[model samples]
Target: MKTIAIYGDSISTGTHGEGGYEAMLKSSLSLERVYNFAVGSSGLTRKTPVGMLEVLDKNPVPKDAELFLIWHGSNDWYWGSGMEEFSHGVKEAVDRLRAAAPTAELVWVTPIYRFECPDGMAQAGEAYELPNKNGYTMLDYYEELEHSSKRLGFPLIDMRRLCGIHRDNANLYLEDRVHPNRAGYQRIGAVLDREIQRFCIY
Candidate 1:
């Protein structure tokens, strides 16, 4: 079986339900070697330095693994990290993955739009001039990750565009407005499966 290592936060990890992209990918592809290495509230620049180190050391992807899917930045952006640090941390993670699995194909996933809520609105209200302290916009992180992937030669599947289709008319996301529900995750998995097939033979 072709192995796949998926690294990301709660969205990809399926913390809310057993319905994230990782689970869907396995079911769609009928592959059993897929590893879900995502953690809730995990940021590329984590509070604990050893957090990433521990993950890397424990689940180093083998050289022959078919692919590595990286779905990061939601938590980092949510934690109020700037572009520079976010970009750097993503690069570091990619670099470390390459070092661990030199021959593996790498697929990067960008963060999507988050819904605005009263609590977030209230946070922005503290500043008076600025509103929506959550700063959850589709435009914020897409281009950043796109350009970075171009520079680094990694294939990226833009989650914004995929999620955008249902974003306007439907509640694709859960109550938190961050994590996607089962239907949302299935949509995401379908997109990734198509893109990865085109990019990789497996």
Candidate 2:
């Protein structure tokens, strides 16, 4: 793709300077622009101060962007954002994206698994399946994305289920069972790159 725009939370707002996924895309493809309008602590619900709604309203998407990736939901689950709210927000966000950039193809990405790593990334955390504040698990969040995307007729990249990172191998990629280290970012980026190519959208 000549240009790309992104919308999501911390995972999507990765350490680009330190070899984040966006950096890999920019360097590998010699992209013209990679507009990552993601912020830390962002989510899909209206309650999120810097969520998708805020990003689209405040950060303008490049008109020439060939593709747009929406990687969120993890933080939504963590914030206990209403499941119904997330579902409706997904459609609203898609409509907003089309209105903003009619030619930019949209793609949805699910959230990766996370855990409470008390000792850090030296090993995989045991409590990877615990529910969040609103009593929703990470799986609940990503699955909701899949359901919403399917109903809305959009291509979705199931990063949570497809990415190789898991409870056993999380320590190798994740720095704190949540954010990915440089190596982790690279691994996830590779999967993402392959998926985008497979869809022939970028």
What's model 1's TM-score?
0.79
lDDT of 1 by residue, 86-157 (tens): 667668878888887787889888776565432334432111122224553335556678878888889888
Best by lDDT: 2
How does candidate 2 score on lDDT? 0.76
Per TM-score, the best of the predicted structures is: 2
| Backbone clash total, candidate 2 | 0
**How many pairs of residues collide in each model?**
0, 0
Which parts of model 2 have CA positions greater than 4 angstroms off?
117-128
Clashes of 1: 0
lDDT of 2 by residue, 1-202 (tens): 7888888887877653265688887876678888888888788877676889877777776788888888888777666677888888998999888887887788888888677522212333333365655656667767787788778878888787677888888778888778888878887788788788787454
Please list all clashing residue pairs in model 2, or write none if there are none: none
Model 1 score (lDDT): 0.65
Per-candidate local distance difference test: 0.65, 0.76
